[model samples]
Each structure stands twice: as structure tokens, then as C-alpha cells.
Target: MIRKIRQYIEAQNLCLPETKIIVGLSGGADSVVLLYALQRLGYSCVAAHCDFHLRGEESFRDEQSACTFAASLQIPFLKTDFDTLGAAHQRAISIEMAARDLRYEWFEHIRQEQQADVIAVAHHRDDSIETMLLNLIRGTGIKGLGGIKPKNGRIIRPLLGVSKQEIMHFAQENALPFVTDSSNLQEDFTRNKIRLSLIPLLQSINPSIEESLVQTMAYLNEAGKIYDRHIQEAIPAVFDEESGRIHIPLLKTFPSPESILFELLKNYGFESERIGDIAHAIDSQSGKEFYSEHYRLVKDRDAFLLSVRTINHEPTTYLLSPTTREIQQPLKLRMRLEEITSDFQIKKENAVAYLDADILQFPFIVRKWKQGDKFVPFGMTHFKKLSDYFNDHKFSKPEKEDAWLLCSGNGDILWVIGHRTDNRYRITERTRRVCCLMMECG
Candidate 1:
């Protein structure tokens, strides 16, 4: 088994000869065997154990046994205890998931502190089979079916090419001391239930079930590589990294729009079930939006805009006093009271607003545009709904979302910042004082 692990490691180029490795030693049969095998293979090994405190004294016993074994092998040992149940409750996750998260996170921390080149975990062929089955039951995509990778970032699984039976046999033959977790026999957990009942029944039908599944996983992994390459090539044309947005034209450029969208959005915390709805919404309306845990996807006129969901800023109204020359927050605007002269030239830029100061009330308010908001656009006689104005001007959903309105103290719209000004505040020839407002993005 050690020779086989050595060959697998060499073939995969998982680590260099002099590379320091940290093994996640749970003192279980699989992990114990992994630690001893890596040591026998002449690699610098450090043992790191996590006591999840799930099985009372059994958990402490496991930790003690792991430390003892590491000492016997004269290896550097590190261990940490976790309140598994409390963590599960806090994270709103299952006990199994919480424990897994805690252990892997600690292992990575140990790896970096120890200057270890790689962290080794004892995940064998059987574990990969179980993972594939679990993913299938949970409605996973192609990547899930690809099964566990031997090397993922700084973690390496040398035992992945071997079976659980082989690992046990090697442990027994080598007289390796290991502690068993009694919780493994319980049917309360989904993984344990699958291992205890489902796998045994499958093994009854075909004794080589694990081997067969391993081969299937290998094929899927290769296929996933090809799929990944295609996604990489399609990304350049379909995604704008600078703006963190995905171009919906990818639907027309790709054969499978839903599949492509799922791949693109999956990393952004979007679920598979929501991808279909988002794809359908892309063709329906420009203002349609969808949200995931961390991101929001807006269906614009020509593309889908993806952005991180930030804390929603409270609707704040900033008062621009007559003495105030500039206000920065919400939007940057420079205001000046200029005496109207024959040489006074109105700027062509929409960002610059020349309003009649005599008609304006003091302490103007700058706020976000709200529903039912109306404005008498410059050169227009009748008031138009702000929503209608946005549509008429061909503002995208994002553009409308970022729109702000400047109004007088009497609640009359003065300027739709960066767009249009109300004709009610427009400078007339008879106006003596002009409030020139120039907006600049910070």
C-alpha cells in the first residue's frame, strides 16, 4: 500500500521529495495507516488531529491515541478541540458538515504555520464512491459526479487510489494502533447510513462495486477537464472581469444557455434551481432581478449584471445650504451663486445645472429617486413620471437603480442628477441670481 501511494504521489507530482507534509491524523484506521505509510515512504510528516467533541470520551480517546502515535513515530503533533454541536447550531449546518469544516480549516492553518508543502487527508476509493453517491442524491452536476480530487490546492490524498479494505488490511498486517469512533456504527447520519446499509447491499450485488465506481469517477474527471477547458475559453468573450458582470449574449453564442449560466453563476452562490429562473428572466424583462446569498443578478437590456450584495445604504437626504459650496456624500456636487450676466454661458454638459436662484427655496434636498416621483423636464411643459422618463431615455436597470434626484426644500424636483433638470428651475433671461450646480462622480 505504501509503495502504491508512493507511485500515485509520483505520478500526480503531488509533492517534492524534501517537501514537508502535514497529515490529518484522526487516529482512525484510515488516517493512522496514512500517517504510518507516509512516514515509511521517507517523507517529513507532521500529525494534526481535531477532536470534534461529538462522542464524549471517545473523542478525547481518539485525540490521545493520535498524539501517542505521533510521539511513537517521533513526528511533530498538533491538535485542537471544537464544540461541534454548538458550531453546527451557530452555522445552521449539519453536525457532519460543521465537523468537516472545522477540521479542514484547522489543518490548513497548521499547514501554513508549519511551512508544510502539502496537507494529506485519508480519503480512499470508498470515500470517493460515497461522495459521488451523495452528490447524485443531492442533484449535483457533472463536477460533483467527477468525485474527489487527489490533490486540491495544498491538500493531497495519497490514499485515494486505494480502497478502504486495502487500508484496513495494511493496518492489521503492520500492527498499527488505531482508535475507532463508535459513531461510525450509528445510522443517524446520512453518510453513516449510506455506508452501513446502501454500500453493503450494493456490494452484495457486485463485490467489485468500489472498483467499478472508481473507474467511472476517473472517466468523469477526464470529461470534467474538457468541460472546464470549454468554460475557460468561453469566459473571455462572455464575462467582463472589471465590472464583475456576465454578458447575456453568451446565450446566443453557446449551445446550452442554461448550462452555461449555471456554471458561470454557481461560484457566485447561485443555486442550480435558481439558474433556470434567471435564464428565463433574461428574455422576459430588463428590470427583472434575482439574488443569491452573496450576489445579485440583474437582467438588463443586452446583458446580465452580476454584483456583490452590499449593505443597502439608508435613504439619506443631504441639505445643501445657501452658504455650502460643495457636498460630497451620495454624490459630489459643486454649487456657486453667480450673478447672471450677458456673457454667462450655459454649459452643454447635462452634469452642469444652471437654475434660477430667485425661484428656488433654501436648504435643497439631495435624495434617491422614489416611486411616483415626477419632474417637469427642461424644455417640457408637463410633468412626467420618473420611471417613464428613465424608460424614454433608454436607461438600463442598473442605471435607473443608481439614479438620484435633487429637489427644493418645498419638495419640487430641481434636477434628476446627471440626466435632466426641471423646467420649473431652469434659468430664464430675467433671472438675476443663478445657482450653478456641477456634479462629478467621486
Candidate 2:
């Protein structure tokens, strides 16, 4: 096992000698064998076990056994506990998915915390074949069909080229005792079902199904590298950034937009279905948008633009009711009452006024836009709907929601946030209060 592992390391060229290696130990046959094999090779390794408390006392036993194995080998052992069932409940996903999430997360946490250069998993040739078959059954892209890589970023699967049969033979020959997980015998999991039901049927035809599939994965892995190189080169051409937006012009070049969208999104770490939705708006007019966890895509001409939603806040209204008063939120309004020597008129845009001063109220409020809002413009006497104004201005749905509007307690729209105020609030010839309000709109 040590000899083959050394060969595997050399073939993959994982890293240099000063690099620290951390092994994920489950106390199962594969992981135990990996721990034993790694220790014999003397590659500066440590065993890290995650006790996903799903199997009750069995989970604790797994951790104990892993600790025992590391103790016997005089290697450092790291242990962690997690509630597998509770995580599933919180995520509202299946137990299998939750366990997978927790497992990888814990593995990465330990890898970083321990400063390990690579986190090794004990996935053998049979496991790789099963992964390929599973991906094929579920429908996957070139990367997924490439199966588990021997070295994926910080992960190194040294036993990926070795078969389960070889590991068992080596364990038996060395008098190694390893516990078997009963779940492997059960056909509930897709992988177990493939191993118990599908591989045998395939072997009936090829006799060397596992070997053939592993060779197939190797070929696909090479092909996938070439495909990935093209995708990486193609990204800058397709991705566009302007006015805080991202778009892909490649959709128009291809007759099948879906294929392009899927490949593009795969590069962006998004699901294919979401990419389909992004491409669906290609023919639609501008301002059409789709949202993801961290990014948003908006249609712009022939380009599919990606945007980061950011909030740029500004002061709402300027009130001139008081002689000398300042509004909070970095905004201040100036007001002064001066007798006019000659007759003159002030436009609504220049200053605010009202027909009467008896109706004016104090403690004026300023705020952003609200739903079901309507206000009269400075020039127009007719009330304009905020939604209609947003539509006319070609604001996206989220942008419309982000717009600000100034209103009064009496349900009067004083100012159309950051632009101008209603003519009803303009200073006129019969103005009793001569006031001015200043806003910090940026």
C-alpha cells in the first residue's frame, strides 16, 4: 500500500516534502487502510475525524477507533462533533446532503486550522467508478463526468487509482483490523445501489467494468482540462461590466443559448437551471433581471450583464418651516423672513411655498419610497403614480424598490425624493413663512 501510494503521489506530483497532510478518518475499511498506509510511508501525516452524530453510539465508536489507530501510529489525532440530523432540519434538505455538507465543511475547517497543505480522502478506484456512474445517471457536464480528481485544489486522493479489492488484500496481508459500515451493504444510497446492482450487470458484459470505467475517467479528465482551458479563455470575451452590471454577449453568437448559458454559469459556480433563466431574458428588453445568492444578471442590449446590488442613500426632503432649524441625517434647512421691497414671484423649483401658512405643520419628516405612493410633480398638476414614474424612467424592479420619496403625515407627497418637490409646497406671493431646506443627496 505504501509503495503504491508513493507511486500515486509521484504520478500526481501533489506537492513538496515540507507540505503537511491531513487524512479524514471514518474508522471504516477504506479510511483505516489509508491511515495505516500513510503512516507506513512516513509522509508527515495526521488523522482528523468528524463525529457526525447520526449513528448514535456508533458515531462515537468511529471517533474512538480513529483515535486508537492514530495513537498506535504515534500520529496526532483531531476530533470534532456535529449534529447531522439538526443540520438537515435547518437546511430543509435530505440527510445525505446535510451530512455531505457538514463533512466537507469540517474537513476544510480542520485543514485550514491545522495549516495542512492537503486534505486527503481514501477514495479508491471503485469509488471513482461509482462517482462516474452516478454522475452519468444523474446527467452531468464534462467536469462532473471526469469523476473525482486525484488532486483537486487542496484535496489529494492517493488511493483513487487503487481498487477496493487491492486495499482489502493489503489489509488482510498485513493483519490490519478495520470496521465495516453496515450502510455500505444497504442499497438505499445511490452509490451503494450502483455498486450492488449496476456494476455487476456492467461486468457481465465487459468482465473488467471497473478498470474500463477508470480508464474512461482518465481520458475524460484530460479532455475536461482542454475544455476548461477554452472556457477560461472565453470568459473575458463574454463577461461585461458597466454601471455595476455584468452581461455575456456570447448568447447571441450561439444558436443554442442554453448550452452557452450552462457552460458560462458552470464557470461562475451557478446551477444550469438558473443559467437557463438568465438566458431566457436574452430576447427581452433591457431592465429585465435575474437574481442569485450573491449576484444579479440584467439584460442590456445583446449583452447579459451581471450587477452587484448596492444601496446609495441620500437625504429626502428640505423643509423651510422654521426660521433657523437643521434636520438630522447630515441635512440642514435654512429659513429667514425678509420683507420684500418690490413685487416678485418665486418658481416652485427655486423655492417651496404654500397658499396658506395656517395649515403648515412642524417636526417635518423625511424618508425613502413606500409602496402605493402617488405625488404631484412640480410642473404638472395631475398626480403621478410612483410605479408609473419608475416604469417611464426604465428602472429595474429592484431599482424601483430602492427609489426614495418624501411624504408628510397628512399623506401629502412633499418631495419626490432627491429630485424636486410638489408645487403645492412651493413658496408663493402669500407666503407667511420664508424657509429653505438643504439635503445631502449624493
Candidate 3:
């Protein structure tokens, strides 16, 4: 078993020579075996446990046992306790899901603080099979059948290629310490029901059920990559973003509006059923909009415009110079000038503004607008709400989020830049000289 595990790690190129690893120990048999096997295979490991205090004293025992096991190997140990039941009540989810979310959040926090290069989880072959079945039984797409990845971002599951039976025997053979969670043997949770009742029934037909499902998942994951590539290449052209709106043209253009809408709505985190609703909303006239936390898809002309809506940014400042760094996307900025030019101009197809450089300061900052950021609209006499100005201009949700302003360090508004230029800095005939400013995008 040890040799087979080593072979799997080598085949996958699992880890670097001395990479720091944090093991998520749930005091279960699978995690226990995974922790010991990683150490046995010559890797640096630390143990971290999440105590959700749902099972009263039993939760404390799991943390104690997890700590002792880490101490046994002289590995660093970390633990956090949470009001798991309270969170479940607040979120209206089961204790299990709340605990799951809490655990992963803490693991990420610890992973960052320890500067651990990789987080090793104990998700064996059988668990992947169970996940596949669970996703299929509920509503799922091709990506759902893909199961869990061996490495996602900073996470690594070294035991993915290992089976639960193999992990159990290895733990027994090494006299490893582990805890038995009674919930695993129950039929209450959906996963437990599938693991306890469904998988065994399927296994009766094929004893190698785990291997078959694992292989199927590998194939499905590969196919999902191809499908995603097609989605990425065509989605932008089919769905347009203009003036902070999201719209889909593929409804009339493509034969399958359902497939196109799914991919389009996905950009805004909308699921398949929601996509069906969003597609249905197209019958309404323009100005029809659907909103999410970060984005909104509105019906506009012939296309469905997807716009981002949520913003919570503390304004920031940046310096700009001709010889300095290249100005990039989604920025409103100002450039420095020693003196006013005879023809001061800022020219873009949509953005064109001129200023008198004599009164303008050298150092300026670019950041998001504040609550009461009133600016003269170049030819206007009064100030308008920066937010209201954006809404009145029909700036799409994303445009508002990406909107920025160049300001003097002394709190004077130079120009709103792309959306609108400020009148205070607008060049006039009375001005002695003009400073030209322009914006170019690749």
C-alpha cells in the first residue's frame, strides 16, 4: 500500500522537494491515514482541526485527539471553535454545511498565516464516487460530474488516487490513532445516505465501483475543459457589455438560446434555472433588468447587457506620468504638467477633455467616487451627485464600478475622465494655455 501510494504521488508529481503542507484533520480514519502516510513518505506536515462544538464534549475530544496526533509527530497544531448550530440557525442550513464552510474558511486563514505552500485534504476515491452520485441525483451539469480536483489553487488532495479501504488498512497496519464519527454510519445526511445506502447497492453489481467512477470523472473533467473553451471563446461576442448593461443577442442569433443563456448568465453567477427566467425576461421591452449581488443583466436593444452592480471600495490615489508605468484598464487618472500647453486636450472616441495646466497641480490621485462627489459637467453651472450623474447618464452597473476620477491631492476634482469631465478644470477661451489629455485602450 505504501509503495502504491508513493507511485501515485510520483505519477501525479504531487509536491515539490520540501514544500510546507497543512493537513486538515477531521479526526476521521481517512484523514488520520492521510496525515501519517504523508509523513511516512518524507514530507513536512502540520495538523489543523476545526471544532464546531455541535457534538458537545465529542467535538472537544476530536480536537484533543487531533492535537495529540500532531504532537506525536512534532507537527504544528492549530484549532478554532465555532458556534456551528448558531450559524446553521442563522443561515437556515444544516449543521453539517455550516461546519463544512467554517472549516474551509479557517483552513484558508491558517494556510495563509503559516505560509504553507500546499493544503493536503483526505478525499479518497470513494468520496469522489459519492460526490458524483450526489451531484447527479440533485441538479448538476457536466462540470458537477467532474468530481473534485486533486489540486485547486493552493489545495492538494494527495489521497485522491487512494481508496478508503486502502487508507483504513494502512491506518490499522501502522497502529494509527483515529476517531469514529457516528454520523458517517448514519442515513440522515444526503452524502451519508448515498455512501451508506446507494454506493453499496451499486457496488454489488461492480466490486470496483470506485475505480470505474473515478475513471469516468477523469474523462468528464477533460470533456468539461473542451466545453468551457468553447464557452469562453464565443460568450463575449454573443453577450455584449456597454454602458454598464448585460444583454444577450444569441437569443435570436443562435439555435440554442438555452445553452447560450446559461453561459451568459453564468458570468453573473446565475444558475441554469435562473438563466431560464432571464431568457424568458427578453420578451419585455428594453430597460428590463435583473440584478445580483455583483452584477445585473439588462435588456438593451438587440443584445442582453450584463453589468456589475455592487461596489464597496475605499478610494485610492495613483500618480501618472508620460515616462511612468502604462495606464491600464478601468482607471480614471490625471497626468502632470510643468506648464500649460497652447492646445491642452484629452482625446478618446468617448472621452475628450482639455484643461488649463497653469492652475492644475503636479501630483494627482485616481480613485472611486465618494458619497457627495458633485462636479461641474464641463458646461454646467451646478454640482450633481456623482452617483446620480452616472445613473442619469445610464452608465451600466459595471461602468459605475469601474468608474474612476483624477483629483488634485488638495481635494479638487480635475475631471471625471471618461464618463464626464469636470467644469472647474475645463479649458476656457479665457485660459492662457491648454493642456491636452487623452485616453487610449488596447
Candidate 2 accuracy as lDDT: 0.71
Off by over 4 Å in 3: 89-94, 205-207, 241-257, 277-296, 307-442
Name the best candidate (by lDDT).
1
Cand. 3 TM to true fold: 0.65
Residue 94, candidate 3: how far off, in angstroms?
A: 4.5
List the candidate numbers ranked by lDDT, top first: 1, 3, 2
**Local distance difference test values of all predictions, in order:** 0.88, 0.71, 0.75
- Please, what are the lDDT tens digits per residue for candidate 2 over residues 1-442? 6788888888889766666889988888888888887777767787988877777777877778888878988889988887889999999999889988898888888888988888888998898888989988986778888788888788889898788999999888887767777789889888999999999999999998787788888899898887777666565556543444334455466455565567866555566667777767777777677766666666755566565555446545444345435554433333334444366445444234322333446545555566677877767779888778766766665555545544554767776555667767765666664434444434
**Candidate maximizing TM-score:** 1
**lDDT tens digits, residues 265-315, model 3?**
666687666777777876767666776667777665555666556555643
Ranked by TM-score, the better of candidates 1 and 3 is 1
lDDT of 1 by residue, 153-239 (tens): 998999988888899999999899998878787898788878999999999999988788888988998999888887777777788
Candidate 1: pairs in clash? none
Return whichever of 1 and 3 wins on lDDT: 1
Q: Which portions of model 1 miss their true places by more than 4 Å? A: 241-245, 310-316, 340-346
